[model samples]
Target: MKNRRLSNLKYEITKNKSTLLAIIFLTLIILISIFAFLIPMDPSATNTSNILKPPSASHIFGTDELGRDYFVRTIYGGRGSLIVGVLAMIISTSIGVAIGTISGYFGGWVDNLIMRSVDVISSIPWMILVTVISIFLKPGLQAIIIVIGLFSWMETARLVRAETLSIKEREYVLYANSIGETSWRIITRHIIPSVFPTIIIAATSSIAGAIMTESALSFLGLGIQPPTASWGNLLQNAQSNLQSSPYMAILPGILIVFTIYSFNKVGNVLRVYLEPKVAER
Candidate 1:
């Protein structure tokens, strides 16, 4: 499996150099996030002497309005963005898998009830729903994560349900059912594993979505909040200084775009290789 994974990755990289570059850059970003504590720069500490400084020898990415280091803040901000992205993805994927598994495996009144709920939720504009929810709740990491997770699971639920419905009809699943395997056991042990590829595709897509949503919310002053460094909040803070300190906006903006593009490329690779339909296409 390990060798196969490497070979597959090598093939993917050879096929799309963008995917290769994306992986390298994303790996560097993740490493930076992990090792941000060791970096000797402060995001919140103000330095009026260096205010509005452009990219220079001392401050490579320059300084912001409060004279804080943009380079360090951008690096540290990645940690938060990645954390929220990962946490929201996990929460959404968990809820989606559970609801989809139950609805697909049972396929009765339970399915109807859950599917109806999904329909109702899907009927609403997702962004409006999330914005409204954020407005009702306090704007912070926790609130944003919960809102993104809750609102984003619908599509994953639908995908998982479809995959489960197809997988549950297979001979192995029917045999397991005949041998007196409990519904829960069969669903957990058999159905979930079968639909895992679909789940992964959903998950990969969700990471970028979560990051973008968080950024949009923060840009609107509804996510992560000030003083705390996040890509979104950084962008928010920089909006006023676009003319004087364009690096403040450009740095974070580039990071966000690059990160999303990387994930998308990686996800595309996963979709083509892991998904049979995609492979056929």
Candidate 2:
């Protein structure tokens, strides 16, 4: 099953050159982030003479006001940025899947109550909510993860709930119920698998959202604090220096664009791949 799935995924990627390129580029970025330590110079190392230098042989991306290497900062920044995004995605997805499963698998006062709660949470302006929450939670990695994860799960929940509603009415579901299978077993064995495509597609977009949110919060001085490098914080520091050293902002900005665009493209690809009707068109 795993091999067959891999084969299908390979075929799907081959069918779309853009998606393949996204995968390859993203893979390279991720590899750099993973092996960031391999880079010769430390990202945080300060050199008074090298500060504000343009992109060159020794310092590829350039240098910041603090004389820190922009290339190293950008590469190392990917680690924290991607980790937070991925972590937030996992937390949100887990909470969403659990709540959605319960809300969807069991319809009644349970669904109504849970769904109403979801409505309340989802109705608020998300960024304002995040800011308000950040004020109390303080700015850091864990706090950012929790806030983003908690708030962002609503979309996934709704999707999962809707998918569950449709799936529970299927013939196999009724058969499982008729055979006296436990609710947990039925949801775990049957329903969850059916809804996984929705989750995967949702997840691709959600990670990108998380990355943006984290960057925004950090940029506003409400997320990852200084001395720590995230794409967002890197951009934050670059703002004041934009006129004098535009590359400070430009490099990280380009990276953020590349990363987010890749994720979005990957999400669209997954959506088409999972939906046979869409893929046909």
Q: Candidates' lDDT values, in order?
A: 0.87, 0.87
How well is each residue in 33-129 modelled by candidate 2, as lDDT tens digits?
Answer: 9999987888888999987999899888888888998888888888889998999999999989989989999999999999999999889998799
Give the lDDT of residue 183 in candidate 2: 99
Supply the TM-score for candidate 2. Answer: 0.92
lDDT of 2: 0.87
Please give the distance, in angstroms, between residue 58's alpha carbon in candidate 2 and its true position after superposition.
1.6
Expressed as tens digits, the lDDT of each residue in 1-281 for candidate 1 is: 55665566567778678888998998999999999999877778999898889899999988888888889889888998998899999999999999999999899999999999999998998768877887689888899899989888999999999999999999999999999999989998999988887888889889999999899888888889878889999999998988877778888999999998888777877766665355422
Off by over 4 Å in 2: 1-11
Location of the lowest summed lDDT over 10 successive residues in candidate 2: 272-281
